[model samples]
Target: MHFQWYPGHMTKAKRMMQENIKLIDLVIELVDARIPVSSRNPDIDELGKNKARLILLNKSDLAEEKQNDAWAEYFKEKGFSVVKVNSKRGGGIKSIQGVIQEACKEKIERDRKRGILNRPVRAMVVGIPNVGKSTFINALAGKACAKTGNKPGVTKGKQWIRLNKNVELLDTPGILWPKFEDQTVGLRLAFIGSIKDEILNTEELAMEMITFLTEKYPGVLEEKYSIEISEDSYECLRRIAESRHCLVKGNELDTNKAAILLIDDFRSGKLGRITLEFPEDYE
Candidate 1:
C-alpha cells in the first residue's frame, strides 16, 4: 500500500514552529522508540539549527529494550541529549529536568555572563504525530497541562507550560513534512499509527505488518495467535482471523476486524517489545 498523509494543519504547524523557534533556547524532540528514524520530522533539524536538542525516545516501553538503548546512543552520537521514556507511565520523567538543565547549560552560562540570572529555559517540544509529545510534556510537568490523546493531531496549537522556575515548555501540535522522500519512511510511520487509520487500508497494512514480523520477528505471530506461520502474509492474517474468531457473517473471516486487532496489538505492546528499525542498519 502506498502511504502518504499530510493534513492541512501540518503546514500551519510548521510555520508556527519556524516563527517560534527564535524564542526558544532548546528543541526537545520526541521520537517513537519503535521506529525512531521514521518518526522524526527532518524539518525540525533545519528549523532548530544552532539550538540545543534533546531527543526523548517516547514510548520506549513499547519497543525492544536493547534497541531502545542503541537508539539513544545513536542520537547521542549525533549530538542530541537523549532519554528513553515511557511517558504514559512516567518511567523517565523525573530525570528530564536535570537533563534539560545539562542540555542548556551553555545557554544558561551565556545568560549569566550578561547579568541574567534564574532565567527559565525556553524549550519547544516537537515531534511527528502520535509520537507522544503531549503525553511527555504532561508527564514532565506532573499535570495535564497539554491535551493528551491516543491518536495524532490532538494538540492543534501552541501552549506554553511552566514546569518550574528553571524550565518552561512550549507544546506544539505534532507536524509531519509535506512529503516523505522515501516510501519506507511513510510505511514505517503508517505501521506505528502516526498516519490516521481512516486514510489507510487496514487489510493491506496488516499484511505488511505480518510480512515484517515473519521476516524480522519470526514465531511471534505463531505464539500470539496459536497458528502456524504461513509464507504468504494474507494466509497468516487469515489464520489470525480464524484463530481469534474474527468472523463476520455466517463464519466468514472478518479480515478487517482481524487487521485492526493485529495493528492494535502491535501498538499496545501485546505483540511484545518490537523495534522495526535498528541503528546498525542506518550505519
Candidate 2:
C-alpha cells in the first residue's frame, strides 16, 4: 500500500516552527525509540542548524531495551545529547534538566561573560504527531501543561510553558514533511500510529506488520494468540482473528477487527518490546 499523510494544517505548523526557530536556544527533538530515523522530520535539521540539539528517545519503554541503548549511543555519536525516556510514566524525566543545562552550556557561558545571568534556556519541543512531545513536556514539568492525545494533530497551535526557573519550553503542533521520498520511512511511521488510521487499509497494514514480526520477532504472535504461525501473513491474520474470536454474522472471521486488534496490541506493547528499525540498517 502507498503510504502518505500530510494534512494542510501541517503546512501551517511548519511555518510556525520556522518563525519560532530564531527564538530557541535548544532544539529538543523527540523520536520514537522503535524507528528513530524514520520518525524524525528532516526539516528540523535544517531549521535548527547551529542550535543545541537533544534527542529524546520517547516511548523507550515500549521498545527493546538493547535497541534503546544502541539508539541513544547512535544519536550521541551524532552530537545530540540523548536520553531514553518513557514520558508516559515519568521514566528518565528527572535527568532532563541537567542534560538541558549541559546541552546549552556554551550559550549559558556566553551569557555569563556578557553579564547575562539566569536567563531560562528556551527550548522548542518537536517531533512528528503522536510521538509524545506534549506528554514529554508534561512529564518534565511535572504537570499537564500541554494538550495531549493518542492520535495525530491533537495539538493545533503553539503554547509556551515555563518548565522551571532555568528552562522554558515552546510546544508546537506535530508536523510531517510535504512528502516522504522514501516510502519505507512512511511505512514505519504508519506502523507506529504516527499516520492516521482513517486513511490506511488496516488489513494490508496488519499484513505488513505480521511480516515484520514473523521475520524480526518470530513466535511472538504464535505465543500471544496460541495459534500456529503461517508463512502467509494473511493466513496468520486469519489465525489471529479466529484465536481472538473476531467474527462477523455467524462465524466468518472479521479480519478487519483482528487487524485493528493486532495493531493496537503492538502499539500498546502487549506484543512485547519491539523495534522496527535498527541503526545498522541505516548505515
Candidate 3:
C-alpha cells in the first residue's frame, strides 16, 4: 500500500530546528532500530553540518541484536558516532556520556586551547515522530524532563534539560519530510508506528507485515499463531484471526481486530526481535 504523512506542524518544527541548530554543539539523532535508514530524516545532514553528530538507535531491545550492530557500523561508516540504545529500559544509556565526549573530542580540545573549560556540550534531540527522542533524553538525563507520548507530535515544542555538568539536551518535536520519495521507506516507518495509525488501513498494513515475515522470518507467524502458513496474506491473516479468537457477531473471523492485534504485537516486540531494514539492503 502507498503511504505518506506530513502534518503542517512538521514544517514549523523543521524551521525551529534550523533556527536553534546554531545554538548547539551536537545533533543527537534518534532512529528506530528496526528501520534505521527509513526512520532518519536526511535533512539533518544539512542542518547539522560542522556539528558533532551522534546517532542513537533507540528502542534497540525491540530489534535484532545482529542487525543493530550492523546498523551502528552503517552510521559510523557514514561518519556518525553511533550507539544502539533501548531508552525505555535504560540499556546503553550509561555509556552515552563517554561516547558524547568522544564524539566531541575535537571541539573539546579547541575549547581548551581557547581557555573555555568545563562547558557542557549543547545537543538537540531530533527524529521522526514516535522514534523515542524525548524518551531517550529522559533516559540520558535520569529524569522525566521532557514530555513524552507514544503518539506522534506529543512534544509540541522545545525543552532544555540539563543532563549533567558535561551535557545539556534540547528536545524538539518530531518532524517528517514533506514527501516520501521512496514508498518503501514510508512503509517501513509505518510498520514501526512512526506514522499515525489513524491515517493507515490496519488490515493492509497487517498484510504487509505478513508478507515480510513469510519471506525473511519464515515460519515465525505459524509458530506464533499455531496455524499453517499460507501463500496468500489474507489467508494468513484469517488464520491469525481464528487462532486469536477474533470473532464477530456471527462467529466469523474478525480480521480487522486481528490486524490491529498483529500490528500491535510487532510494534511491542511480542512478534520477536524483528528488524525491517538491513544495511545490505541499502548497499
The global C-alpha lDDT for each of the candidates, from Candidate 1 onward, is 0.86, 0.87, 0.85
lDDT of 2 at 264: 97
Estimated TM-score for each candidate: 0.91, 0.91, 0.91
What is the Cα-based lDDT of residue 104 in candidate 2? 99
Off by over 4 Å in 3: 144-159, 173-179
Worst 10 residues of 3 by lDDT: 146-155
Candidate 1 accuracy as lDDT = 0.86
Candidate 1 Cα deviation (angstroms), residue 234: 1.0
Candidate 2 structure quality by residue, lDDT tens digits, 1-283: 8975646777786887877788789999999999999888888888889999999999999999999999988888888999999999999999999999999999999999999999989898888888988778777877545432232332345566777778878765456553578888888888998888999999999999999999999989999999999899999999999999999998999999999999999999999999999989877
* lDDT of each residue in 61-172, candidate 3, tens digit only: 9999999999999889989999889898899999999999999999999999999999888788888888877677777877445433232332345556777778877765
Measured over all alpha carbons after superposition, the RMSD of each candidate to the real structure, in angstroms, is 5.0, 5.0, 4.8
User: How accurate locally is residue 24 in candidate 1, as Cα lDDT from 0 to 100?
Assistant: 86
Model 2 lowest lDDT segment of ten: 147-156
The sequence of per-residue lDDT tens digits that candidate 1 reaches over residues 91-153 is 989999999999999999999999999988988888877888777777787754543223233
Of the candidates numbered 1 and 3, which has the greater TM-score value? Answer: 3
Residue pairs in candidate 3 whose N, alpha carbon or C atoms collide under 3 angstroms: none
